[model samples]
Target chain A: MLEVKNLTVSFGSHTVVNNVSFSLGEKQWLMIVGPNGAGKSTIVNAISQGVPYRGSVYFSGKDLAGLKPSELARKVGVLSQRRFVSYSFTVEEVVRLGRYAYSSSIFSGRSDDDEAKIEEALEVTGMKPFRGKSVLTLSGGELQRTFLAQVFAQDPRLLILDEPMNHLDLVYQKQMLELIRRWVGENGRAVISVMHDLNHAWAYGTDALLLDKGRVVAWGKTADVLTNENLQSVYSMDVYDWMRSLLSRWSR
Target chain B: MSKRPEGFKPVAYILFAAAMMTVMVLCICAGSVNIPVKDTFTAIWNTVFDLPMPEDIPWSIIILVRLPRVLCVALAGGALSLCGGAMQGLLRNPLADGYTLGVSSGAALGAVIAIAFGIYVPGFALAGTMAMAMLFAFLSLVFILSITYRLDCSLSTNTIILMGVIFTMFANSIMSLIVVFAGERIRSIMFWTMGSFAGSNYVNAIVVFAALLVFGTAILLYSRELNAFAIGEDNARHVGVNVRKVKLVVLISVSALISVCVSISGTVGFVGLVIPHMVRMLAGPNHKRLLPASLFSGAVFLMLADLLGRTMLKPLEIPIGVVTSFIGSVVFVYIFYSSRKAK
Candidate 1:
């Protein structure tokens, strides 16, 4: 389980994520939805230890206040909105990097178990076809999947993805979401993803958190929190009716 | 696409052989005095194979003076360019080179002090000067790295470049003041600053060769770490790279290499800055390929530059620094134009 308590993040004098709190049990998925600059991404970043925050985040009964990046990486896998690669590394090489946290000794060679995990990750993301290809040569959608394969190789207890579907097409979007859902179901892991598409959040997410201007406006089960009133208020658009129709379609 | 070849071993061997041949021929053919290719080969073969010395040619000058100078040039050039290539990876900046981050300026100041003070203590003058250069280079690297650490932020390429520029300006100003105050040693200091292959003997050649071997091997061992760093520090850290530790190791290793080169050759410019970029143009930005390629190409490029410097002016003998800058600027301009066009 993962719990965030009174999380507050500020940039300079302005607050970006204000007094946000939430909890997620194993085998649960929480999708956060908000408009641009609404602090949804900031909250995700704060939870992933990408940014400093004022409050507490606990994972599996341990305080995550001062954990080193490597320690945090072992427990949580994060996929940020922007990923940059400056070298022409093969897809397999990049995925193998995910085993860094688990490698016991620095000088010792990578073991058979590491290769097995990497192969499993490649199989899960369906990136085995391009495993030997240079990541710099990959297309946008294919690159995203490659990164997903890396994240899967991490085998973390908590998965945090910020805009995982940003550049993906509809087919890849479905493929990635289905993979995430299946992984969580089988491993009983916790996932928190920030998404812009309301239909996608409603379709795969078990719970929803709505943020507005860095404040959580509503948080609960997906169906309870994603009301017409809340959606209209948060988005500042008369999209409640459309959202309701979409929700019905998602249920079917 | 067609099935990729099983391995790159054949291409690697071909490149290695080609580079070796080019370096050997260029080394022999270059110098102020025009020794025939046949004579050069005979001299080399006689020395190595312990055969009878040829009577017509002066074997002493070729073996003692010219051979060591050429070897030093090749080794130093290869080491500097390889360091520059590794720096670009370590710093994640395409423009990074051996002299970036103020290492060359620090070395120059060390050399300037050594000459101006006339710090000659019997047989220890050269050793003392080289030690001073290494010390200054290491100190400046530590200062930059400490500042980077204190900031607790990734050292951005822009920040490091700016820091290097500031240090370079400061060192140059101090050097200028020393030059003004002490005019007697001006000739010696100027010679050191302008850079040359003169007076390079077997000792300096051996030192540079050994240093290059050690530094190059150290860098190759960290190839994976360098590749991770290329992706940015946050990602590298997430991938379990000890970013700070790796940065310190690379900084120290490259600083040592640059200091040793500067001690012997006195800041042969442009080879460090341009050769790595040229190598990257041929081989993509993969460090595994780029690092070794840069080393070989840098050696060849500097040998060619030295040859041009030696032969172009004939008896006058233009400085190697001058030739390198002239060639490098043209290449830089071409790169700039082509990159802009591609964009």
Candidate 2:
């Protein structure tokens, strides 16, 4: 379980995220939806304690700020925006990085359990075949999936993913969402994802938090918060009118 | 494509260790006065085991003259290469080494000043040059860290490398000024800058060994953290590495280790820069394999280079620095070309 209270992030005089608050429980999936520059990713960063902010974030009833990074990492996994790496590493090796928190010492090799988890994560992401391949040679979508496998191997109780679907194809998109859903459904873990796709959020999210200009616009069930009026106001699009026009065009 | 299999690492390490042992024996045997390999082995075994000394062997030449120099060469090489591997991982730059970062220049400046001013510490067991070199090496490390910190972009290789370049320029200018006024001490200063193990004794070799054990073991403990850092600082943090603490500890300890190395054997070039890259090329980028591999390869490479320097012209000993730098530049160019081709 995770809780955020009046989280605010600012740079100099410009506030990126305002006093917004929300609570997420185990087995719940919260999708943050907003337009560009709407503080959506900032909220994820704030809650994950990756960036400096005012207010408090609690994980399992303890203040997130008080926990050491290695300690917090055991409970929460984070996947930020995609970035490039300078060195060449095998896909299996990159995924093994996720087990860093579990590794007892540098002198010891990975335990049998860690290897099993790595294999399972690779299998879950359909990356088992590429275990011996270099990450430098992977395509964007493949690299994205490789990192996803890494986060999965972390096996954290709370997963905070910022734009996890950025480079994924439609098939992988489906697979990823299904895997995340199962993580919550079967394992009772929690997931908070920042998403740009309203349709995906509506179909997959149990709860939705809409943010615009650093303020929370709405927070509730996905269906309740994704009404035509709310979509029109927040996204500046007449959803119903546009849908009708698109439907007419398709009929023609 | 994937690299050579991970199994290649242990094999490579064993080969390198064997090469290091062979080079050590050859270095002890092939000095100005040639002692047969058999005599060299007997002298070394008898001295190490403290058995009755061999009456027919040149015990003084083998033990006092050559063995200490060989040990110093190997230790300095290992220390430099380990520092290089750590810095490259820390800076996320494959080319990073003490010379590039001006840390070695700082130590050289300290040594030159000590020699020029005749500043000697009576109580210290090691040479005054070693003590002053350690002092100035620490100072240079502190200075570099301060500038990088003040720039507030420690993660950016461009900023760090640029600051290093500027620091090197500043230090070199001071060194030039010292050379201009150094008059009678110019030869000594030049020899020190060019690096050598000619005057090394068993005591200093032990000191270098102790430094390698302490600092090298500590760096090995941080191999996991270094692997994470090589990816990116933020990525390292995500993987539960305390990035700041790891960087600080590695930088300080490595600088101290290099300073101790420079103190005993002067500032050997390319052993740090080239050996790590060679190890990585052979064993891949994982620090667990790369660290120890670099250590063995470095020791072997430097001992060979030192042997070449001594025997190339016979009695006209070339500075070890010159040989390594020459080889290092060729390797640097080759790496640059290959990396570009990779792109």
Candidate 3:
């Protein structure tokens, strides 16, 4: 269980994320969709403690601000749109880095569970072949999977992703979503993803939060949040009509 | 071709250890006054065993001048490179080093002030100048980092480097003013700032080694955090690294190291930047390996560079800083080209 209570991120007089409050429970996947500058990613940044915000993010009824970095890491994992790595690190090494929260000291050896979790993450993400390959040498989609394996290995209770499907091909996009669905389906885990693709928000997200500028335009079940009126106000366009018209073209 | 994942190997370390020992001995023996190889070993052995003193030039050189200077060079070189590796990783900048970051100039200003005023403390291991140098160095690091955070919260490379350049110029201007008013102390100040091991003694070596032992351990302990840092601070945070705490601890440790080094031998640039790059290439980017390997490689590099400085012009010794800059510039150019092309 995770609760973000009235979280607000502001820079001087300019607010990026304003009074955004939401909760995520087991088996629930929440998608945050908005136009550019709507602060969709800012909410993700706030919840993950990537940026400072004037509010509270409670995880499993515990205040995250009071938690140690290692403790907080065991509860939340994030897969960002881009992973910054300029050095030459193998994919396995990158995945194993997720075990930092579990590891006590660098001098100590890895436990059986640590190794097993890493191996399973590698298998699930299909990054086994690239285990020994440098992260610098990976393709965009392959690199995305490598970091997905990293999050899987982290084994957190909640996963927060920012544009997880950015730069992914159609095939990889489907595979990554399927893997994430299974991940949440098994462990009583919850997820929050920032998505630009409205179709993906409809298909994959259980609940939705639509944002415009810095405020919430609509929130609740995906169907309710994506209604014609809600979409029109936020996007200022006939989104459902356009989608339905496009749907007719694909019909057999 | 894919590189096979390589982990810790005892053999590489064993060879590295041997090379360290061999290079140190060679450096000690091959100075302007060439001591015999046998005498060099014999002198060290007798001193270690506390046997009878040999009344010889070779023995005195090993006991008095060369040994202490070599020891100090090793400590300074190793610490400089270690800090460079950590800073580069933290900022995700290839060009980050003590000299480039303006920390050396700040420490140099501290040391210059101490030298100009003839500040010295009897009975204390670290002189008054070294203490001042460390303080100013840490302050400089804080100054630049806070400035970068203010300009850009991400601590991007360009902002950090710009702040560092401006700070270095400011510090150097103050140093030049000190030089102007220094009077008779100008020669010592210039020679020291240019960087040399000619003035090193046992006290300087031992004190610096103590500082390195304390702070170097701190940096080495944060190797995991540095590894995460390379992947971006947000990624590191999600992995449970306390970024603020790590930043505080590592910055303090690195500053302390650079201060002690600059206080001993003025602004030996590029050892930190170059050695870490080499270590990462050889042992991979895992900080666990890179940190220790940096210590060893940097020590050897400095010993050799100092040896070249002493013997290059025979009667006229080149400053150790000049020698490093000469070599560092070439290597740095290669790295600059390669890193840009990588993008």
Candidate 4:
């Protein structure tokens, strides 16, 4: 479980996220939806403690402020939006970096369990075949999957993802969401993801928070928060009929 | 996935270490006063085991002269190469090194000032030129770091490298001024800038070697953290790497090592820049293997370069910097062409 209270983030005079708050229960998936610059990514970043914020984010009843970076990482795995690797490490090596928090020494930190987890993550991401290939040689979708595998190997209780499906094709997108659903189903984990596609939020999210210009437009169950009027007002488009048709099809 | 495990190859490391030692011995035998390989090995063994040196061996050539020069050369080369690798990892750029970052020029400025005014540390036998060089090197890095820090912008690899180039130009201008003033000693200044180990001794060599051992191990211990950093700073932080701490430790360690190298053996150009690139090409980009491999290969490269410097004209020795630059430029061209072709 994770709780954020009155979180406010700003850069200089420009406020990006203002007075937003939300809590994620165990085994729950919360999707943050908004148009461009709606501060969805900033909200997730504040919760993950990636940037300095004006409010408190508590993880499993512990204040995130008191935790060391490694301590915070033990319970939280974050998949950021942009990842750039200048060097050419093998895919396996990149995945193994997720074990850094579990490592006690530089030389002998990885255990048998860790290796198995790495392999399992690779398998789940469909990257098992390319484990030996240099990450530099991977395509954009493959590279995204490589990072997805890394986060999976981290084995954190709470996963914070910003635009997790950015480079993924339709099959991988469905596969990645299914994997997250299975993880929550099995391990009682929680997920907070920022998504631009309302269809994805409607299908995968148990709860949704709709934001507009750093302000919350609606929050509650995904279906209730993404009402036709709210969708029309937030996006300034007449999508009521389109949203209803899509929801009917998804429900069926 | 392949069934074979993926880690640094032990055989490659062993070969590199053996080659470095072999080249070291060959260098000792091929100096101005050519000592036999057998006598060189015997003297080295005697020194290692505290046995009495044989009377037939030339003590000056084996102990007083060649040994210290060779050790100094190897240590300087190893330290520079390691710093280069660490710099590349820290900034997440393959082209970063002391030479490109102006750290070497900063040390050269310090050395030039000391030589110009005849300023030497009294009663600190190994502390004269080296102490000044290290001081200026530290100051130069601090200046560069502060400028970047004060900008309060995310530190980009391009920005830091550009800062380094600017600092290099500034230092070079001052150095040029000093060179112009020293009408009679221009050749010595030029030789110093070109880099050499001809002026070293056993005392300074031992000191620099000890420093390298201590700091080099510290840097190696951060290979895992460096691996995380290779994925960009945000990912590194997300994965629990203390980005600021890692950067500080790496910067301090690398700057200290570069200062030590420059103090002992002027600014030997491409050993720092090209050795890491060469090692990465051979061993992939894992810092765990690349760091130590670069050290070994850099030692061999510099030893061969210094040897060529000594024997190319059979008495009219070329400068070590000249030899390295020539070889480095060729390697740079080859690497550029190959990388473009691969792409």
Candidate 5:
């Protein structure tokens, strides 16, 4: 299980993520939804140790206060919304970097298991065909999948993806969400995703955390926290009645 | 796809670099004087083994003067190019070079000031100037970097470039003022500005060669970290890199290399700017291969430039700085046009 207690992250004098507390059980999927500047990304960044925050994050019964980046990477894999590569690394070479945390030593020869994991990640992400191609020349959807393959290759206990569906098409969006859901369900690992699409979050997430202006407005089971009134208030849209009718139809 | 194993590629690159270094050393030895290959080996053997010098052997001509100067040129060339390549990776800017951050101008101003004031015992003036240049090069780097850090803005690529230009202009004005006031030293200052490898001896050559070896190996050891840094500090940190530590290492190593090169060659230009980009064009930007390749190729390139400078005008040796600029500008123009055509 992963737990965050009173997580408060500030920039200068302004608090971007204030007093946010939550936990995720094994095999659970928690989706965070908020409008722009609602501090959703900041919260994920804090939990992933990408930014400074004033609180305690406990993972697997250990405080992550002074842990180094490599140690944190061993247990938590993070995929930020922006992905940039300055060189023309081949897809296979790029995927191999994910195994850096698992390697016994910097100079040690790669084991067969490492190669196997890489191959499996590529296969699962449907990137097997582009393994030898340079990632620099890939299309947007292909590049996103390549990064997903890298995350899968990492094989961390906890996966945190910030807007993983940004550049993906409809088919890739379905493929990626199904893949993450299956991974969590089968492996009993925790997955937290920050998403903007309310319908997709409701469809795929087992739990939901809603935020407004850096504070958690609601948290719990997806169905309960995603009520029409909460959606209308958080999103500031009058689509609650239409969303309720659609939810009822989907339930049937 | 077949796997070549994880660490094999970097080893191959190292071996290639060694081979290139050997070829460059031989080329440096075989110069306008046209010493036979056998005689060159004999001279090297006698010097290393401390054997009795043959009555006919030319010790002063071969070992004492030409060899040390040649080695110094090679060392400065390799160090400047390698540091330039690493700086480009660290700053994530293709235009970054050894001289880009005002280091060359700072060194030049320091040397000129030392010269104008005659800040040494009569015979030790050049040595004092070199020491002063090294000191000023490091100080200038620290000053610029601290100011940039204190500004509390993201160190964007354009901002770094702008700061570098501003600092360069400041250093240039100081150097110009010194040159104008000390009119009698203009000839010496002009010679120093147009770099020459005239008086390099074994003592200074050893110092330069050792510094280059240490700095080059240090940069190569951090090749993976440099590759991570090229993507940006935030991305590097996200990927589990200690960004601050890596940046410090790169900055210190590059600064040391530049200082040493300035001490020896008096601000030879364009090798740092052109060679690394040419290497990247050929080998891609992976520092694992790029660093070592730039080192060897840079040595060869500068040695050839030195040979041309010496041989082009037989009795009157041209300054190496002019030769390198002429050759480098031609190559750069060709590369620019070809890349544009490709686009």
Candidate 6:
């Protein structure tokens, strides 16, 4: 459903993502994992057309760069590392903003019950109770859920999320991943997410791409790519033993 | 979630519009020339329907003098407030306005130069004044941005405001020089700088209203895009808002309207600075409501301010800028205290 060909991104003389190429078919959930400044967000930013890049990112056979912002947005929904809402807008209003590509003009208002897609999104994200709450007063976890509901409402075929659950609580993180799993279970839908938690990636990702220093260290089925050798080399630490030790701390 | 949040509220619209019209009509009866409210209404009705005027003294007052001044005041108020509302949305900072961005000073500089040299566009002095003011306003934004960029690549809020202040000081110094050299026009320059609606007429009123209608509607149309910025510009872009295009259209339109306002009533302080923040507090920060509320509320606020300035001393009128700054500062203090307390 999406393709990145020799994607290279840089800042002045500093190269952040170098000659990284990967592709995903429909129903695939590709998890990008790396340490700090591993260019996970940069790669996602490049795919979402938020940054200029040397290589092309094709979405459903169309080059994303050639599309208008609204056109690109129709096919791609991105949940960024969220920022705080300082104003007094309700969560519903913020979520409704995701439908900008579908709205007729900037002046158009939210549609009625007949077009209740947004309401459905709010429901799935478990933000139904807080839909009317002012986003400014929301806690970090609630705010993240509100934005997650927003991306859900955008109803794009491909979801690109950069550390989407960073602000979410543990239970909500599981719920968010479940929602994504359900979403990608459908036809013609896929996801590319940058995650910090290897456990979540191993558990949730069907396809995983491990990146180190902006280059792809391993890429294949999640089970194949997240081997002890691959994880140890990229992280410079023992992977399975560390998980076992952490589990032992709470063991009976 | 079965019940959607409120969308557009016609009640608020009707209420604001009615209040604006009512205040504007009542303010027509101000000034020492005591025209009765009945006469004011009759003259206004006659003029609206294009009937032949009654040819009385009150008819001339309503048709010729009071009407234009009132319109100019209302337009300036709406223009400045809308400019502030849009700037606050684009910058996602409540403090962003023409005054803080040095755009108002740039506009005042333009108006001052035109008045100093007696520059007029043949028969239309208003055009020359507005043209020069708009030019300087745009240039001032560009200059402030360029200088700020040179100093700080990130263009942080601190750097931008600092540049604005530096530019404002430099522009004011030059304006002072112009005021100093004016031998005969010193009185007019002083009045212009102080911000007043004295001797206004139909030409100034109609031209400014037309400009406001165009630019003001532009801002209103872009309100949704502005709403997207509430999260932050980067996220706004992620949601398909062409942030750059929205910013350019809004800022240019705002500067143009503000230039027209300054050309009419010389940098009336705090209408822009205070009105949007006040309206946002009352109406909530959805730009859809906030921008339009700023429009009507600003009109009423300025009308009351100008009227008070005109009548408070009877014979000795206070400057409109002085009245607003005095009142606005008090109201702003209360807002700060209340917001802090709420926090």
Relative to the real complex, the DockQ score for model 6 comes to 0.59
The residue-by-residue lDDT of candidate 4 on A8-118, one tens digit each, is: 899999999999988889888999998999999988887767788898899889998788888888889998768666788989999988877888766674588788889
| Candidate 3 local lDDT, residue A6 | 92
Tens digit per residue, CA lDDT, model 4, B1-343: 2335444678977787788888889998997778889898888788889899889988667777777888888888888899888888876767678887789989888877776766777776346666677778878987986897677455565577678889988987898788789766433665656887886798778877887888888888888787787677778888888888888788778777887787777778868779999889888888888898888887888888898898889778788999998877687567556655655
How do the residues B1-343 of candidate 2 rate in per-residue lDDT, one tens digit apiece? 3233333456666787788888899999997788999998888898889988878999999999889899999988888999999888877777788876778878877877787787777877356877787788878977886788688755455566567668867776787688779777644655656788998898888888988888899898888789888877767877777777898889877877888887776678767889999888777788878888888888888899999999999989999999999998798678767766766
Interface RMSD of each: 3.8, 3.1, 3.3, 1.6, 2.2, 1.6
Candidate 4: true contacts recovered, fraction:
0.77
Among these predicted structures, which one has the highest TM-score?
A: 3
Candidate order (TM-score): 3, 6, 4, 2, 5, 1
lDDT of 2 by residue, A1-252 (tens): 788999999989999999999988888899999889999988887776678999999988889898887887788888776667667778888888888988766656657788888889999888999998888789777887787788889888888889988867898788888888887785558999999988789889999999889999989888888888787788898976876776688786
What residue runs in model 3 are displaced by over 4 Å at the alpha carbon? B1-7, B48-50, B54-57, B117-122, B186-189
State the C-alpha RMSD over the true interface residues for candidate 4, after superposing those residues: 1.6
Pick by lDDT: which candidate is best? Answer: 3
* Candidate 1, lDDT over the whole model: 0.79
- DockQ scores of the candidates: 0.38, 0.50, 0.64, 0.66, 0.41, 0.59
Q: Is the docking of candidate 4 incorrect, acceptable, medium or high quality?
A: medium
CA shift of B189, model 2, Å? 3.8
lDDT of candidate 1 over B110-206, digit per residue (tens): 7677777875457755676666777788887777656765664566555776777688678777877887887876545545555788888889988
lDDT of 5 by residue, A29-99 (tens): 99999889989999888887878999889998877767777677777888776776555667876677677
- For the second chain, the TM-scores of the candidates in order are 0.86, 0.87, 0.92, 0.86, 0.82, 0.89
